[model samples]
Target: MEGYLDIIIRCVSVYFFMLIALRIFGKQELSQLNTADVILILLISNSVQNAMVGTDSSLVGGLIAAFILFLINYIIKKWLMKSTFFGSLIEQKPEILIRNGRSDFKMLSKLGINSDELSEAMREHGVEHIKDVKLAMMEIDGNISIVTTDQNQFKETHYKRKHNHKNLQGEN
Candidate 1:
């Protein structure tokens, strides 16, 4: 029981460290990670294992860390919902990567994003060329939000097609 308490304390400390680190690191979207960001996360997790578990191969430390992580995440989420400045601090602001089928070279360069990377993001979304993209934004969470000129019409047509199919099914 005494040993368990010590493990809990260690785990809590590690949990706080992770929370503060994440807070300081700000927000990153799933699409925008460079090589350095991925490596740092892996290394941070490795280092925390020693600090949280010490020499003991026990589950107590792991459980404590998990609980604290969940709690901190909940709190931060609530805070984000209430405050725009806090949201910006944690989630970052979205950047316009393309407008009117033209790339914003200045923003792209500032973010260390090259043309190839931007093209790849567009490719993932089934865009064959930049000309088809009317507006492309690098969202705060690092996701790419693309707006094609024909998307609205495409959505309307798709909705009508679905409605017609549902009516046919009903008649059957």
Candidate 2:
């Protein structure tokens, strides 16, 4: 029982460390993983395994750690739904990238979004020209949602981005 308690504490620490690291580094879409990113994740898991298990490499120890991780994740998800403050701390807010057919250059620069990517996203939404976009926003989930007009018909399209945008500072 004492060994299991140690395992639980270690796993809980690793889980929260990972959560904070991901939030700080800007969470990217899992589908957009590159070779290096995949390797990094694998290496990270390997390195953290020993830390969580310490000297106890028994099957029971591993299971206890896994259970602790799952339990903590479940609690966090429930809290996120019920608590706005908790959700805000863990999630990035959506930002307007383009408004009234004009690109917010400061917002773009801060987000490290280049013009070509913006253009591509716009085209994906069927907006041939940037000037025609009524609104474009970077959603919290690392997706670009473009709103456009075609022959008086409002159209909105959303697609996942490979990279997450950094928060823009001062004058959004």
Q: What stretches of model 1 exceed 4 Å from their correct place?
A: 1-29, 32-40, 53-58, 126-129, 151-172
Q: Give me the candidate number with maximum TM-score.
A: 2
Model 2: per-residue lDDT, tens digit, 53-169?
A: 899999899988888989999999999999999999987778889997899999888777888778777766778888788889988776788877556755545565665322211
Candidate 1 per-residue C-alpha lDDT over 42-133 given as tens digits, one digit per residue, 9 for 90 to 100: 99889888787677775765676567667767887899899988876666677898998999999877666667667766665557789888
Off by over 4 Å in 2: 29-31, 151-157, 164-172
Report, for all candidates in order, the number of backbone clashes: 2, 0
Tell me the whole-model lDDT of each prediction, alpha carbons only: 0.63, 0.78
Q: Over the full model, what C-alpha lDDT does candidate 1 score relative to the true structure?
A: 0.63
